[model samples]
Target: MPINSSLASLSDMAFGTAFVIYLLAMILSVVFYVKAAGEKPEGAQKFIGMTQSLVWLGIIVHLVSVVTRGLATHRFPFGNLYEYIAMITLFAMVVAAIFMQRREFKPLWPWVLVPVLSLLFLGGKNLYADAAPVVPALQSAWLPIHVSVVASGASIGLISGVASLLYLLRRWQPEGKEKGFFGKLAKPLPGAKRLDLVAYRTAIITVPVFGLGIILGAIWAESAWGRPWNWDPKETFSLITWFLYAAYLHARATSGWQNTKAAWINIVALAAMTFNLFFINLVTSGLHSYAGLN
Candidate 1:
């Protein structure tokens, strides 16, 4: 069945509104983090807890908005650039929350959540478009499977990138009490060596799933477009991203590229993924033009 145009428009409005709410929550969280930095012994804990609560609330609303939009469209909510970004941001938040809770990586929350919030805002402002029904090319079972896995992998990449950034901030801290906001922020971040290990762990978890997603994408392309590799801009960039991360893994395992250097390579790999998802889809034209804003 086709979605009613009017209903789709309303859903978009709700999603956009929810996105704004999430952005506001992120701002509040950041403010609290700043305040906590200057607070006394007990006040800091309360501020952090409040900030975390706000973040959680924002995530809940965001999740509901995305799920409703998906149901209304009668397809996975990743058929277009807008939905793709929203889903990716959602996955990133989920991964961050889970990792923070499970691995006791609470100190990394400020760094990780800020980027997730930024992505949410970007998805709403830059990528927002009317949700439409899926095209014939995207009306395959593999569509959701492929996108979900890839998005999760991208979430891991996001976490790794943030960890790398934190690692850099911590590694360069100055001596004495003149560390400033960034210096204080760096205090709780894992050591440079630990940050490198965490980043590699994230990439290791993501790379194989990303590889599977690409392989499945190729199979789906063969079935739909009659070719497994079309040399599309998106495909090319994705392959490049895969290879970059692959190199990161190889260098770490064999070439002895560890610490800041490995973190830098992970940052580059994540950048390639971001460019493939955002710039290639928006600025360039190709088979993935289907991802462009309407």
Candidate 2:
């Protein structure tokens, strides 16, 4: 089906507006965190409330943008790299926002908002694509199913990994009463032990979902290409990412590899997923090339 140009334009407008809102929310979150560093608890609460409201508002607008694109195209609206990135960003934001519902995630708003804002900016500014029908390969029902699961896992992993990184930073620089910049940053973050546990549990929950996405992709591949494991660049890198996470989890049960080392492995897994998302799609050639819109 052809795109409705007017609807598509409206969708783009919403997307751009959402990006600005997310950027504003990111700034507000940082201000909120900074205020939290001081002794003014009431003032800090004011900023935090404002930040949370902005984030939720941006999320609602973004959701409408995604849905409007789907309406414009009468499909999932993720045929090309632009839509793919947009979906990933949207799903990530949704998950991050849900986690933020818990007050424990309050201090992590800025950390969460930065990536979401960056992704929305790049997607809107540089990777914008008009609403279009899916490519032949993407016409199957499997791609959206596979992609939603995989993207959700990626988002969960990314945010949890960021928490792990913060865990390390906090460990390297303990919380103190000083009003310095680093001190302020460290004060709000949960301890390394707490962060590590959160990251681990998140990984545990996400890995199976990601694995199921891969399984579905293989099923789709068998139908599309008459084979399930052709070792495409994207597939291969995805497997590598899966294995890294597997090893990280297994190592967690080991005697000596359960602390910072496991956290480091999760970081590497996060990097591998990033490379798969961008490098494999953009720089490499394979069956998934259509996904890059190349």
Candidate 3:
């Protein structure tokens, strides 16, 4: 078999296997948390051990899938939206796993995965790509540099959003007085205060990385498109996301915008970011239409 073809097949198999493993981790996590709530006699530690191990295993498999795809394409693997989705999600999973190692963030470990899994599912099903030579538009040396950093920044920002969302949903469950299925689930989540800390810290790290990414893109654009900024739909929306995040940080520093309000702003920031990724890249035609969907 051809090397690229063999690698592509292996990538597909790895992607599918990672998805199944993540699903199993989610199930195991649910069981672990339920038992941790003391309703069952079985040890929760064992389940958590299995869940964490499976999570790392899934990450390794997904990493293999991404690396293989890049090898198959004989270029950077981030040329299309399909590839972007898978790789960015891999970054998110890595961040979530690191955060999960913290005791304050441990209980909500599996919850952090719910979004990553969903994105992976979407990527694997709807945005999958076959290995091929990319268009000249994607031939720039910056493909691996600019786009990779941008994707990493975006992935880290996604984790911040997940933490913020969890904070909002479980902000009221501190005393465990709340009664409901979700409430029980929320019981293990870090308190609003802790979640806020993580969200803020994570966002802070992302800001500089994302900003640098935009700047790098500008540099690439200057070389590729004869101008640094074209006000393209993708660029415009990216600016919007950056400013929204800026406003989120600003609001946090200002009066009365701390807690829930700031959380909402971060959520909206994430929403804008997601919209920029899908809608701008897929629905609208522009310079960033490298999604390869058509």
lDDT of 2 by residue, 1-294 (tens): 677888888889888888888888888778878777667745776777788888888888888888888899888766787777778788778777777777767888888888777777767666666677777778888867888888877878887678778777777767664356777778877667877787788788668877878898899889999999899999999988988887777877689775788888888898898888778887888889875444
Measure candidate 3: CA RMSD: 1.9
Q: Of the candidates numbered 1 and 2, which has the greater TM-score value?
A: 2
* Model 3: per-residue Cα lDDT over 67-150, one tens digit each: 998888788888888889888889988988888886557677677778788888888888887777788888989999999999
Clashes of each: 0, 0, 0
Q: Point out the worst 10-residue segment of candidate 2 by lDDT.
A: 172-181
Which residue pairs overlap in candidate 1's backbone? Answer: none
- Candidates' TM-scores? 0.88, 0.93, 0.94
lDDT of candidates 1 onward, in order: 0.74, 0.79, 0.85
Clashing pairs in 2: none
| lDDT winner between candidates 1 and 3 | 3
| Rank list by lDDT | 3, 2, 1
Stretches of model 1 off by over 4 angstroms after superposition: 4-10, 17-21, 39-41, 102-104, 174-182
Over 4 Å off in model 3, which ranges?
A: 1-3, 38-42
Q: What is the lDDT of candidate 2?
A: 0.79
